[model samples]
Target: MPDLAYYASLPRTRGAAAALLLDDLGRVLLVKPTYKEGWFLPGGVIEAGESPLAACVRECEEELGLVPRLDGLVCVDWGPPRDGVDAVNVFVFAGSLTAAEIAAIRLPPDELSDHVLVAPEKVPELAPPHVSRRMEPSLRGLVEHRAVYLEDGREPGYGSAPLASAPRPGGPG
Candidate 1:
């Protein structure tokens, strides 16, 4: 077995923050990135020394050109290691956009190509499976006014168990 010091010396987990921005029509905002396939929430990787909430705000500004005040976290997912890539911790927060705010969206062409307000039910069809997993529960949390935990974009309880505090700033939970 690895010693405690060995475990402590392991590389730190990376984190990303995203928001589920709902419009008055109860639709969620999805972004098309220039660099990747499928639609994604308006967020990006959290920079070092940045809090997840701050990262969400910054990413929204950069990708969607909207300054939004996010509410408390809705979901925190512990993504599993995959395809040789390091595991990541993803934080999802909830924000709402007025019709005027939606109209004012000006996406950064370099990073994002398009933005759309998708109905909650259609999110599963529009987003990748894992992303949809994270998004669906997050929407529920927003409506239910509670927080939830996930593992690899799934509600903890099955293949991947959920954690009380999954992705903390300093390291993985």
Candidate 2:
């Protein structure tokens, strides 16, 4: 086994988790952060020792004041190093919200400014490119009951088999 120091010296990768929430109309729910320029999905960075699904649920509650019953995994994207940041992994979960849940949304004034439900196709217009690229595949995965793997938000080469029936890490919603 590698020494503790040796293991500690290995590169560390960051993780983040987000949810793809939809309304009964099939419109995607997006949030506008006070600290950021563009809209984002309801999510945030994964804290130490926290699972992606847990992080997603926590973030949703923190940002939107609601805990949604997330469905299966939608996408697992490996974001390449860019700018001055190291590579990071992002996990997206899918779920739908009832009218009551939508009505209960309450943004933290310091963190988020507003929330909107938009057509999936319009995601590209509001979100950053990296986030936009994940939308299509994530939406498709939700519809196909599969999970997609992406590199820098795009599938690599010919793409691998869809994890349609694979056991998801987080149990069912």
Candidate 3:
């Protein structure tokens, strides 16, 4: 028989997806929301039955008016429940944008108010503390060419180790 207590201890989390789009100059794109105070990455809570990758794709189109080809998963962070919301698994995918693509971005007035491309180092000043912390690993993942797993925007073991090896050509045997 299954242990009810053990099952109860398991985490029940919601899923959210975002895309990290970088311009040709290596700057990241941040979107200003009409309903939110700070800038954020282009994405939203994942709808039921939708894959995170698909949700990321849909969000980019809905929020930014551009269809960016998401390359790979960049960062996955487990965030604690906050503000009446349940604990959430945030998946951030990496994508690239040319200067022309960025210039053509048209914000959806109902959701986003504006968009800007800024240097990665300036993320702290432009976004919320939690968001900036989450972005750090994603940016590092972009440079390192690997995805990173995080808990509350920080790596496990205080950055001492990686949860998974970078994708290799051959299967793990």
Top TM-score hit: 2
lDDT of 2 at 129: 96
Q: How displaced is residue 124 in candidate 3, in Å? A: 0.5
- The alpha-carbon lDDT assigned to residue 113 of candidate 2 equals 94
- Candidate 3 versus the native: TM-score? 0.83
Instruction: List pairs with backbone clashes in candidate 1.
Output: none
Candidate 2 error regions (>4 Å): 158-173
Assess every candidate by TM-score.
Answer: 0.84, 0.88, 0.83
- Regions more than 4 Å wrong, model 1: 1-8, 158-173
lDDT of 2 by residue, 1-173 (tens): 75999888988889999999999999999999998799999999999899999999999999989899899899999998898988899999999999999999999999999999999999999999999999999999999999999998898874364556545689763
If ranked by TM-score, best first, what sequence of candidates would result?
2, 1, 3
| Local distance difference test, candidate 1 | 0.86
What is the C-alpha local distance difference test score of each model? Answer: 0.86, 0.93, 0.88
